[model samples]
Target chain A: MKLRRIEGDLWEIPREGRMRVPGRVYSVGPPAPDDPALQQVANVAHLPGILRFSLAMPDIHWGYGFPIGGVAAMDAEHGAVSPGGVGYDINCGVRVLTTALEAEDVRPRLHAVTAQLYRDIPTGVGAKSAIPRLSDDALDEVLAGGARWAVRRGFAAASDDAERCEEGGRLSGADPSAVSARARTRGADQLGTLGSGNHFLEVDRIAEVYDPVVAEAFGLVPGRVAIQIHTGSRGLGYQVCDEFVAEIAARRGEFGEDYATLPDPQLAAAPIASALGQRYLGAMQAAANFAWANRQVMTGLAVRALLHALAISERELGARVLYDVCHNVAKLEEHAVDGVVRRVLVHRKGATRCFGPGDPRVPAPYRAAGQPVLIPGDMGRYSYVLAGTARAMADTFGSSCHGAGRLMSRGEALRRGRGRSIARELAARGIEVIARGKKTLAEEMSEAYKDVAQVVAVMDGAGISRLVARLEPMGVIKG
Target chain B: MRLSLPQPYEDLGHTADVGVRTRGATAEEALARLVLAFAALAAGGAAVAAEREERVAVEGGPGLAGSAVALLRELLYRLATEALVPAACEVLRVDAAGTEAVVAFGRRDPVLHAEGADLKAVTWHAARLEREGAGWVAQAVFDI
Candidate 1:
């Protein structure tokens, strides 16, 4: 499929046949050669009841199930949802924590903070959380309450956290019955944990403020310190994917002979109206809620760790959730198509929601300010905070890049790290680092990614999101 | 093929870290044996000892972090394709950030002690390898 350049940062893949919509790609230049992301956009176009153009964010990459940064909206009435669309790590997302402490105030405690975070937060693959295991009934509450569940359980404070989350941290229609027994078993003890690979807890300083009004609204002051927690549902989400993929594989032939031609087997799916589709959606939403709750609990744990290390009270620390948003998810949203408002299931894998100003889905406090867009860069580089724009609603379905996309494989990072002491190296740069595995540290080395600056620039140029603040890393804890 | 007790890794899923090396009459012959070791894990029992030529290409970071994952994935790919896992792998050419290698299989293949499932990916968790004395020590995490 040839991608025809449309404008400054947009490309279009014409709807050839059997496609409900054409495909639109957002990028800076021609996509990287041999990029399969375009193919994913085309595949999404073929899904039943798709509206407008199947969208791909600027940070698009080849992914197993859905192309990373892929988004497609399927009409709620005529469309179908696919588990491949939401990805294995359901609701994998990022959360930023603001602090009253300045960079200088925390400089001496950076090492202690990193160590404390690592010890307090469960990390690494299969790492269990310190929180108690949930019973079947309690798990049901988590599905419905999300961050609210944590707050009620004393994991997080409702006063401090309830307003800063998308959907107030709890999405509606999360039915625990939709979750499989295997998923529950796997997630039973994984709450309040930061699982491995790309998930991290980083200490950062507000480096630059681009919009003082928005920065002040977000409680972000230049040189003020903050923490970023990046994680998701962990093993539980994996279990859901594992269960659904097998279920889909068992019934792929039922989708008819044409299903075999699917560009990628990972895209195997059932019709949105099918029983399988409903089951997958229910489970996925439950898992997504689990992830939201997981991050909230982890945030609370970090706050406690900070208070202990600094010998300060919660009020003194002034730690609060700036904003929490999930990048990997499939959501039911209403978008206008050809002048008609239609409910569509939008799948965003490795893409963050950037709802424009005045969008009702955006919380009331931020109605005029627009939704916050948090884009975390590499540890050695910088991360950014942006706001949604009206153009995002008119063009790209209110979505933006997730992070500095990976440029090198993990094997490459370790190979490059041969004799280097990554820990010592970061410490010398005024950053503290701690991890469960050296190889993970190496594979995730700052050099293994595209400069997030370039990635964010494309989104900004494309008018999907607007820059608000830039943050510099002071310490990091990796699983 | 004989099984060995490897150390448990903190992050690797259901994996064993074993020290493996191969030597033959020549360097090329020895390298071929190493590939065999890797193939043995994926390939099930099949009679008739035969050799076939294969090519492996890896790019980006060359050391254990970057190359090991691709190398392992390639080895698994072959096993998935041939339905016969190599018993051992021989490193033919190991440039700092890259590697070239061959594999060897067992003579009389027995029922393989593995399952019929795709090994989706190899992760960076606990992936490490160090040159100790004359040989190399390494570890990796796989998404099974």
Candidate 2:
């Protein structure tokens, strides 16, 4: 269980006890001695056909099977895909859009803008969408076509919205038939709605620019207004993950005795070529598409809300997507393994894909400067924008930390925030926060999360991602 | 009604999610209590009056753990789609195949009944349903 400092900003757990590979953690310093994330990393190494090492970003924290901020690449020919690696919220991600307006222009109307956003975008537990419910056929199209469906339906500003997303906002293998009717029923009316617990929509300002050239390329300049949306496939994704994990675990007897010895039953997996695996991939991809479409629809909603709040036209607002990134997902990508390039299924659970500059996968507009990575911090503080690096490709499978990871449990946060006015606290700091209830505000206070600047600094020092800009939240809406 | 002496469930600490541990006189009783516990958490400690009933059927191959997860997921699905909160659950039958139950739930009224943590899913992580002495105990972790 001892983590050895193998190099600067890197630590390793030597292979032992049925581990197929060593466990690697990217950190600015050694992890706390009793951190459960170390054990989770080691547990992931026990997975079948894990290549090189089971990796964790500096934001690593204890999770069910794979630690949050964990990354692993498994050989497609021999490896298995586990739902736990993608977590329950399939394709949970962040999307940031830039506007022509500057912070000074919106500062005076922060309250009105935030209120309009809250009114237009539904939030809270089981909040229904402002849009009408989708018919079965429409829902299926959304699942299969992803953000493309949104663009087609006029929910997106242009086709470029799809182009700016990972997988072009549509996973090619998504099979609507693979998804269960129950999941569809749960998702039918939830599009464009933000579900509770850590999901949010924030209006921020580019507070500072680090790499001015890259920032300009990303359309991020100091004092400019930007909007960030964080959400996922909603109830649909959770049901897909739940059904598969149970199905695979129930069939463990058929996977041979080796399966019975897995460190956690929740780590249930099937070979990539197996029937169950193919079915799961189809369903997962469909959920991923649903999420992309969800965010896309929300983007349109946000634009309308912002324009309405400011009593301006779309031309005046000039809202446009900067980029969208999926954090919880698994995809087949070609990567160099032991010096030979091969296709592998990369599982990034609470980790973002950060393809370096010049990679074909990077969106063409940003190909020369790498993909833009959005790291949202907790309310009442600053978020970050970073660009991928070549070192990320060579060392960490082109993945980086997702967000400012949780530093306290929700219960602990609530207890600590007891009798305190979280809204007043934020307002005093010149930030406006709107939520359905006070409990969510307390549960999500800034103290509950690690300083995102510190987390980004670790990634920057490790050379996986370099800073581009810092965004300070001016107004926030939480679900 | 007028209830028992010992509390059937208690909340356990988790780093990022919510966990519950329940005890009952039998496995069926324990499963029922677990359902009520889940409902309580979802209801955010609001007093729920059972005014309606919902039937749920789930199948698991062998162990009690898989069956428990299936049951919990069914409850969650119903809650998400129908806005019903279970106040009580009666285990109708249990076999090697699975369990069938009828849950009595409260009507959806956001004005009168506020929502609590929005549980995303019930995970199988470290889930346990076992016999301890002459009684049974069950534990589950929920993604909120």
Candidate 3:
């Protein structure tokens, strides 16, 4: 509500009360009045050691605790990292896996490939997966080591494909001791599961090229096939959030009203100095590692499904990890404050990190090209690939929009979809779809979201990110 | 109007996704009747045949022009989780109050049916309560 326009695609919400800094939002136009993005921005100001501004991306939407497109940076030593900022789906993000195989190569096997994927990857709400459960020690190791654990287990190959991921699919400071028994219980058998609600694995092809150099860097070429996996930590992450929210609410009095105001009861929060705050951060990091591991294992399953469906060896399919980035997460990173370097806990909720080329945090192989940012559109439209830029670092601590924000809610989309055969409509358009739930398919109808291409264009024009390539869906498997 | 129980998923044992269509002289009566229809489907015609009186309030404002649809979701969540059943909605106030009021069938369990879809959370997609040619109609999609 304290918003004032700073420039094109930029707005500021000055920090007030116990807030440590002002809040910043990135939108091409004035944000929707009902959007709670400003409120989320204001809430981030309450975290201790917060630097520069609490930020929100253009796809902002109302969410529990933090607005979906919210971002905030808290000092590593003195600031608090709230699990609410990263959301219940810890490390719930998108991974784009490119293959040398062309769309035509997989066209004939589309149905079999989708069925294989669905059979191999567990899905639906509360759906328990068939993937083997890990021992307590193995689970802890997975939490601490992430994709590296899978690679060591022979699930992934360390090749040119291995270095493109964020931290090569691993994160630091993951202490499994911080996680609770209940969290472990929920996550035990869900390793390769694709939890329901906005999660999907889509088969796609490079549909268009917006930037030749960036596309080449990302190994994407027009007509080349790819697979996009969108998921997260599942039940483990949900239990973590549920436990923390209750804990924070019970101790809300200690932080004072400014830090604990529950304008929405779900947004209840506490100061960074609190014990619960530290525990939540530790557990969140551990869950994030689990998510990365989950994706890695799922990616392995995807490879197996493709190999069997296409009747070829792994070398022939050339299915490799292009890049895996966590969109919903919080990490400790160094950023400039008044032109001086400082460590801060950056919370990216429904947002992705856009570290510029040469940023120390980026993986070594991609240090010269910046972090690969994947923005996926709804099934009917084009998804974009972008690279982080120094401009984003100088302005937004290196942040950018995530996807085509929802324009119509699932219920709204379903009401409009009544009597009309949504699946038939999509099939008519050439996209084969498969899902266990009719409701999930109806809610995800292509008309439910804004055009992601347009949103990416705004960020590209604004110079926060540069266009890499566009991906169009060939086959989609939803939960 | 169609009402039936769906399979249970994680939280509740069984959930119901109700679809209502009606034509009448009074909008309030139509909404009340719709709630009754849902109650019957939830309780089954056998258990709900015996009627009891209960009063309740439904709430929403500018954001809930289609609140008739959201009201069902609120009722469903409460019914499945809290075991509260609705009998009737007064509908004296429509989209005026921050919330809506109704005279709901108040009971525990309502003798839930054996078969049902596992309606998960209430989704924001395709939710609408609208005015049709003769009366009002509403449709909502529940995550299953």
Candidate 4:
């Protein structure tokens, strides 16, 4: 792979072969020669009607077809839509909430709060639902309504939570009928439950504020305790992607004229105008909606547990959702292309939308500051809150890195963590770590990830997104 | 006290994903062994009792890889939806195109058995079945 420096934390793979666009990456260090993610980036460039560049964020890492933290936009009318691009976990996103209580107030009772949360919120594989099983009609409503459904059912911590979410929680064009029966069955019981593997509920405190103005605008007060929910559409999302990716890959010839030439079979795509593509879009949107509602419902459960454990009234907690942003998704957005603005379906896998100030799509309350980009780091260290910037819109389709990318494989992490108590290790750092299995914690130890500060610094240095505040983890519950 | 048999497949690690590699004297044996390895993983290494038996079939493409994927997918779907863990997989027949196998299953008791990894989907990344060292070896990666 040939790499060229493009000034200031940016690198490019010059368009060659059957590539329709050049490949771009934001990182302090260039990718290794044999990195599969490098090839994955180049392969994305081969997609039809790709615009500007097949872009990657600073925390880029090896994912199945698309590199995690990768972003690409395609011409709506002339391009392809790959289920693989959005990933199996549709709308796997982060929700950040600000609370009135300070870290000092919650530090002593953190363990009780965490234990109550674990008991209140279902965790682990085959975890039962916290809410009663939904009827078929209600399931359809959830598929279509997203966080709005949660709010209606009183599963939202705040009334305006849905309003603060990306696309107002429910994605437009969701066709519940498009969602398969198996997905519905699997997802119906998963609402308010936290699924396993990298999914978590974290309690954090604002340790530093970089942009005080923006922080104030978003209600992120320094030293205030906050909550973060990291999850997705769960089995529902996975089933939808699995069905479509396999169906499209097997019937690739029927979906596109040049399907056989796809750089990777997993990168199989359908023409945006094709029936299969439309069907996938409808189903994917449904899954994305389910995830929003899922997160919102979990928020309600966690907030309840916190209030109970602290023996405080809801008003006293003063919790308000700041923002909910999806990292894995594809959205039709208008962006500048070749000196002209046009609509493109931007695929963000392990990436977050960071629309700059003045975009009407941004919620009204924080419109002056820009959309809040939530990046969840490892359990031990700190997470970040960034504000979208005009440079982000100009450079990477209003996208930014999601988190500290994996530096080592899960196997490697386990091999290194052998005989060491990861929980005690985190406890020594003043972080209460509660997980079902030690293996999961070991696999997710901080050493398994790159320094998140470095990853975010690249985007900040590149002027794409700016840091607003940082949240240090005080406690964590991994499903 | 029991003597557990050595696993046919070993962990094949990637930078972000996980997989299994298996070797057997024949393609059928290799495919069957691959099925057991993944099933055991989904059961979190718990010993599944052979409470019932069923013959499973999957249409194949050109080689063992495609058939293996189809088989694993069917099993994954069953495990996720029905909690049916394969206690033993005996490949009745296998060819370049398709496969037929008899699997002994244990109805996984959530309270009795260990909870397992969510085997989201069986992906087609680097999946293959080939002859190596006078034996058949196969590998597949699951999207976890």
Best by lDDT: 2
Query: Candidate 1, residue A23: CA error in Å?
Result: 2.8
lDDT of each: 0.72, 0.87, 0.69, 0.86
Q: Per-residue lDDT of A265-375 in model 4, one digit per residue for the tens?
A: 778898887899899999999999999999999988988998999999998899999999999999999998767999999999999999999999999998999999999
Over 4 Å off, model 3: A14-20, A157-162, A262-264, A271-274, B1-144
Candidate 4 chain A has its poorest 10 consecutive residues by lDDT at: A251-260
Better of 3 and 4 by TM-score: 4
Q: What's model 4's lDDT at A344?
A: 97
Model-by-model DockQ, in order: 0.04, 0.65, 0.05, 0.55
Give the runs in model 4 whose Cα sits over 4 Å from its true position.
Answer: B1-6, B60-63, B94-98, B108-115
Which tens-of-lDDT digit does each residue in B24-130 have in candidate 4? 88887788788887877777777777788888987765357777877888888888778888888788877666788888888766655544566777877667777
Task: Select the stronger candidate by TM-score from 1 and 3.
Answer: 1
Better of 1 and 4 by lDDT: 4
Model 1 C-alpha lDDT per residue in residues B23-107, reported as the tens digit of each score: 3344333334434433332232222244543446654133443455446655543443244444444456544456676544333
**Docking quality level of the chain pair in candidate 3:** incorrect
Instruction: Provide the TM-score of chain B versus the true chain B for each model in turn.
Output: 0.53, 0.87, 0.59, 0.89
Q: Tens digits of per-residue lDDT for model 1 on A27-121? A: 75688645656777787777666778888887776665466788877778666677778877889999998888989989998888778888999
Return the top candidate by DockQ.
2
As for lDDT, the candidate ahead, 1 or 3, is: 1
lDDT of 2 by residue, A400-448 (tens): 9999988887888889999999999999998999988788898899998
Model 1 Cα displacement at A31 (Å)? 1.4
Q: Give the Å shift of residue B136 in candidate 1.
A: 29
